[model samples]
Target chain A: MSQTFSLAIDAMGGDNAPDIVLDGLELAAERHPKARFLLIGDEARIGAMLARRPRAAKLCMLRHAPGVISAEMKPTAALRQGRNSSMRLAIDAVASGEASGVVSAGNTGALMALAKIVVKTLPEIDRPALAAITPSARGDVVMLDLGANVQCDARNLVEFAVMGDTFARAVLGLTAPSFGLLNVGSEELKGDERVRQAAEVLRESHIGPNFHGFIEGHDIAAGTVDVVVTDGFTGNVALKTGEGALKLMRDLLRQVFTSSVPARMGYLLARPALDRLREWMDPRRYNGAILLGLNGVVVKSHGGTDATGFAHAVDVAMDMVTHRFNDRIREGLSMLSTPARVPVPATAPR
Target chain B: MSQTFSLAIDAMGGDNAPDIVLDGLELAAERHPKARFLLIGDEARIGAMLARRPRAAKLCMLRHAPGVISAEMKPTAALRQGRNSSMRLAIDAVASGEASGVVSAGNTGALMALAKIVVKTLPEIDRPALAAITPSARGDVVMLDLGANVQCDARNLVEFAVMGDTFARAVLGLTAPSFGLLNVGSEELKGDERVRQAAEVLRESHIGPNFHGFIEGHDIAAGTVDVVVTDGFTGNVALKTGEGALKLMRDLLRQVFTSSVPARMGYLLARPALDRLREWMDPRRYNGAILLGLNGVVVKSHGGTDATGFAHAVDVAMDMVTHRFNDRIREGLSMLSTPARVPVPATAPR
Candidate 1:
């Protein structure tokens, strides 16, 4: 536990709202007893929930916010009408230097929009990327632009590489994490000009020794490198596609274990190992999406996630705060040379 | 089996070459006894292998092709230097009307480049798309543009919809296949201009009744639609990412079951069910990548696959030929109004 650390919590976000948010804090507080929280939401509801959890209530400083950003609200609308929203106030705490970071399980678009406008991005960063830590065959891999900038130029992609590199080192505990640019194919001449130019910049950068060249989609789960970087469109698609595949497997396995009496008996015998497997593959273990290149750390937890998942998101925000993630990014960016200008084609190459 | 149906075979394409090709023919021949093959490769090697399977040998006509396209060869280079290649000859047979279709397990880029040039595309089709039938929760899902055209305009996407619709009906035996345009989100305004315009066109076309609107990446495995349409880059990445996720699941399951003695016993008891699950998930059963919008049926098998997988590719080609896939596509295209000219943005939208 970091004795001086504190984080802002958006208590009114997510499906379960104040209940799960308070419950999550109770769990997180047990793990990091010294850390404090500035809980921003409806004071009455939060206070009632906090009363039920005495320890979490003792550690939380409740602040009243009259509005909440609905999950279905558009980013532009949220920005225009969300002055006193819990999500906004929580992020403001980080910008006002009251907290080291902010965590929310609210509307993704709203959170991202507010974070960008309120905390703003680093001076060297053009756009912040959404990075997630996913379990891979080798270990954990950090992938960026999970759903941030849908369209990216070579400069944007190069910036993501630097941020993702810094992220892997801080969170995954990798000393020199190898990163790869995600493309349709691993060849030097496979994708569009933007991808090729990003590869070229990385190849010539100070961190070139840590660059693993281009890698295909399959390399993500294979853990071909420590960081996998791509534009939000492909990265988002790839992320959801992976989730879909995993769900399909789970469904198929359920059918298999229930097909016969022998399978039922086998299920009993294998229950322990199966339990371990479930724990290993649990979504809660990797619940947070860190918005990189932002001036302050902002972690987005899945809106539908339970208390356990929310706790994991809190853990991610704490990790960044304790590790000085922003300082490292600034250092990394300062050490790099700007990528050469390459005219990207209007359309993708054949 | 249609007695008149004969598929041109690239006998020296895959990793195993003539031996696997001949062996695959033997297996495929059993499933379609009336079908004949025009096998193209080194005569002596194919002949010697064909001799081992007398039944297959009797049904095959061997053609000599001294060259082979290496996996690493670029598409342009392959077309330039691989004129006498087995892959090229097989595609040539289709163009010359000597064979109903062509099946190749060669380099994907080379196979695609040659097929597009020699066999040509449908008169109304602007670009050919690679289609694959993947197993899903509800049943099999047909997805297209899996690396055929890197970037696609709205017109290109509309064509893919028509072709994908026909492909699902022919291969999956669906009477009316519902199709969805793949995008980052399900909202009409979620993705770039190309996707929205494609959706608009589909909304007004003859197939509008069958169009299910925009779907996210998870919809591919959810089997929300019978056909999933996307540009080549996203589709290809999604396909490989699914494969990677499945592989990760398998590795994790193995570790889970083998962790303890009870788990091992349970695995044995569940062995029958597990085997069935494995069979259902086997890559060989879904090995072919059909190049849709082509004038003739063309199937690309995995270059590293064995006889069983190759046979599956042949089975796919046979399905297309028997169903008159090209004619169906022409009919589908003729029934629809041309896509309205909507300006597609150069890159995916934020």
Candidate 2:
């Protein structure tokens, strides 16, 4: 089966649905060349929106989805009853093997609930994670459990660490990626018992000390590690804090830049550099929140994400398909079962 | 009622203790003309080191304490066996009402454990929070539960918010302190059952909505709210992560600044601007963790804090002294008794 024309997008989801979704899909189609999208939304509305735009030749035909999942709807009801809801329908397409992967900008709760119940996890995979790209000091940091599972067990964290490592390797193209635990301190035994136990499991596992042990929020921007692992609760806080902080700084910078004529002049002179800095720090750079440890890849974009962000998500999906990330995760798990494994050299970043 | 002329330093704690501890205290004393110290350690070694330095006045006099508290020492054991230890003597000076406040560069567990037993918390206060200053996008952001309690409860959170608010208003001088529960989302229903309950208590409490409401980790740095509150466990994690991310950024910026010839040239020209930015982002600017809800003001500085960091801590102490912060906290709590009477401003950074 040709896996080229993949990605089933939850077109009816997000704040600016169908319009932004279609725009993202169209741009992604142009960028990927090989990729096509199955837009899940009301056929008439989607078609109307499409007609207004100079449609890309690669735009996949619209797939009518009967209902739109309200962002505020309860996840339980949304998952159980949202059969025709665009988000659910998108997931259904993936579940039924009509699409290679799925992307949603709907309520995270509903998406997680539906994906876990329908798309399901691979054998021995107890839970899935909401992994987002965090701004680290060095580069982008992949933070897991942005808000999926609140209560985490040691085994779950280990799985998260492993899954995050795989995602980093596949998407970021960093082989033998460095992993760090989100903790209060860098030293061993500095965090809660659960974190401490997870650290031990990570250390003893084949992952080795590329497992850089404990990391704090300050380290998030340091880029000391490729992947930072934690429970959904903590990771959600960290991710939001990072995003909020970046936005806040930019806002403050703008305020200061516009405070006085001299400052404004300085800002103008430094516009290119500042723009580069802002662009680098912008949340749009890392738009996709990929849910890992499942049979198929699932990427969640922000509800307010625009076409640019959507295009990035699609690119991430393409990378997922090209790298066969899920297979690598399965293979990594299998390698754990077999002892005395040969050392794998780290995958350097592209 | 008389405070001591000198203090006993905890020569060991954190990753860069003893050495950094000595350097920091020495620097603090030199900078502050009124400051004096009583170094607690091996008399011979401390004396020898002191002799090597040019001394004017009895600035830092050594006080011998044979045993040391290891950073890994269990809290209970540290308290039990530390009767004659350096930490206790320092606290003893305070319990005996000799020193105004004690400073330690030793294990946090031991310090807090000793502090609770000796200094004790204020009446009506359920627990004391390890409150500290965080550099937000705009300015200083106050957070609590930096490293005290672990298992979180709604009541505990209520106390944290109340005390954290007072701390912010008194310490940071914000018009009306923002109070927020560091949870998964800004919405009232976000996070675990405990967090949901806490959010309600916070929302309906005398603290008004302008007092700010539920804040996520992202809100901490986003500068939307002035104060971010959580249990020690979560707060501790956020604090560390923030610190780690900042350090990572600093290190990475250094790398980027010296990456190539053009970069090096830019660094030279932009040195002044970059220096200004670094100062604005300096962790030291917002240093010192306040053990709030306690009877007396107590600040926990980085055991490895340099002179600059220590000065920040001293400033925090001075601010507390000047603002009568403890009294304000008590007043804030007492106001809670007349439920329908007063309004406590909720200033949560969103």
Query: For candidate 1, lDDT tens digit of each residue in A1-350?
Result: 23223799999999999788889999998887878899999998888889889878878889999999999999999999998999999988888878889999999989999999999999988789999988788988999888787777787888899999999999999999999998888989997777887888888887899999998888988999999999888888888888888889988888889999999999999998888777777888989999999878999999999999999999999889889999999999887864432332343312
Candidate 2: where is the Cα deviation over 4 Å? A1-5, A48-56, A208-210, A255-275, A334-350, B1-85, B121-123, B204-211, B247-277, B322-324, B327-350
Best by TM-score, which number? Answer: 1
* DockQ per candidate: 0.62, 0.32
Provide chain B's TM-score, model 2: 0.84
Query: What C-alpha lDDT does candidate 2 achieve relative to the native structure?
Result: 0.72
In order, candidate lDDTs are 0.88, 0.72
User: Residues B1-350, candidate 1, lDDT per residue (tens digit)?
Assistant: 23343799999998988778888999998998888889999997778888889878877899999999999999999989999999999988888888989999999999999999998988878899999988788889999889998777787898899999999999999998999998888877687777887888889898899999998888888899999999888899899988898889888888878988999999999999998888888889989999998878899999889999999999999999889889999999888864433433343422
Give the per-residue lDDT digits (tens) of candidate 2, residues A41-89: 8987887777665443345757898898888888888966798898988
Q: What is the lDDT of residue B89 in candidate 2?
A: 74
At residue A240, give the lDDT of candidate 1.
86
Top DockQ hit: 1
- Tell me the spans in candidate 1 whose CA falls farther than 4 Å from its real position: A1-5, A338-350, B1-5, B338-350
Compare the candidates by lDDT and give the number of the best one.
1
Query: How would you class the docking of model 2?
Result: acceptable
